[model samples]
Target: FHDFLSVLLCGHKIQAKLSSNDKKLLPFLASYLCAVAPEFKPFITFTEDTLKNFDAVIATGSNNTATYFDHYFSKYPHIIRKNRNAVAIITGKETPKQMQSLADDVYRYFGLGCRNVSKIYIPQQYNLDHFFNGMYAWKQVINNHKYINNYDYNKAVYLMSDIKLFDNEFMLLKEDTGYSSPISVVFYERYKDINDVKAQLEDQKQNIQCIVSLEDVPFGVAQTPALSDYADGVDTIDFLIKL
Candidate 1:
């Protein structure tokens, strides 16, 4: 929605159909936006049929929803999106400050946003003490009832299933190949070579939103995307210009 908000500035008529699940929070959000930008009030509507005549479409959601959007809107000029997650590459050489920043990037939004780092790649045989120490700063996140509930539940399930886990009270670190981890958990994989990790990431590029490391988007700042840093690496402005 933030990206498409620019469409209005370009003098294009823009409206959105709110999904059934998003109704809980989107109405309040729309009301707040309308309060500040009255011109935006009319562009939001609850009726799905109101968007039947749109010239172009921008759809974002899970993979299943993306499939449905592509099927329905394929005839139109559209940018349908699937879920994408950010990841971090951790070298053993990071300073404590950088580690802390990475922790903030992972925990800032309680690891819910697509830009949040849901996984990390660490060097083989790397000591995790530094990482755990950095994460201590966000230990207070356990105070959130919802977050702690997830933490406790996932921890118990993992323990009962005999899955090895690294527990930090508030977060669980699991070794897994997946990108999207459960709430309060961060999936991880060990890398013997950095180039191998890079190759795997390239192979799975469509599933990844951003790479956080010293060489890529930095340790922290994944959620703090610049206006031009388009989602899924698709340049919306360029798409608009071409259209």
Candidate 2:
């Protein structure tokens, strides 16, 4: 549902490939078109074998599925996407409003979309109190059943294994090296050098959708992707034009 919602919100920016692990979305998409598609408008194709007919293809899925698409679509012109995430870098100088806005980037869409900020880079010795002050505004997310359920599940698993986590009922923060976080959880890493962190991020550029910072895409704007903001930094227009 999150994937479909993301497609509905941002798919028009480029030719989107809506991938489902199962073919469950077929009926749903078809039903939606039947209900809302206007009579004068042309119909979009609905097909079981989507890959065979298209001249070129764009596929989105998990890291493992990406490898499968690469092998199968190598002969054809295609784009195969792997999992990616957005992250924020904190300098501890941000105002309460800035942190509040950052909370929106973290909590909006329940943090399921790729553009959602799932990790944070903060300076050493940064005060957690200030960061929590900003994040506190979004505490109401715990009231959501789905979000709370995920929170409980992840928290239980971690606690059973004796893992340490910094949490405030609704959100969990863990010091980790990974870029991706599980639902209802966010990873955090402390950084001493901005340039060093930038270099590190560049090393793993393919796994990142975007960087959220005061200097880059501002807080609360991750969901509002622009025409040029192609996922994984692939220029879809250039790729299409060349094809």
Candidate number of the best lDDT = 1
Pairs of residues at least 3 apart in sequence or in different chains that clash in candidate 2: none
TM-score of each: 0.90, 0.83
| Candidate 1 displacement at residue 182 in angstroms | 0.3
**lDDT for predicted candidate 1 compared with the true structure:** 0.86
Q: Ten-residue segment with the worst summed lDDT in candidate 2?
A: 7-16
The residue-by-residue lDDT of candidate 2 on 51-82, one tens digit each, is 34555667788899899989988888877788
Candidate 2's displacement at residue 156, Å, is 1.3
Per-prediction tally of clashes: 0, 0
How would you encode candidate 1's per-residue C-alpha lDDT over 1-243 as one tens digit per residue? 665455655556666677675656656776888899998866765556657667788888899989998998889888888999999999898999889989888998788888899999999999999998988888999999999999999999999999999987788999999999998999999999999999999999999999999899988799898888889988777666666
Alpha-carbon lDDT, every model: 0.86, 0.79
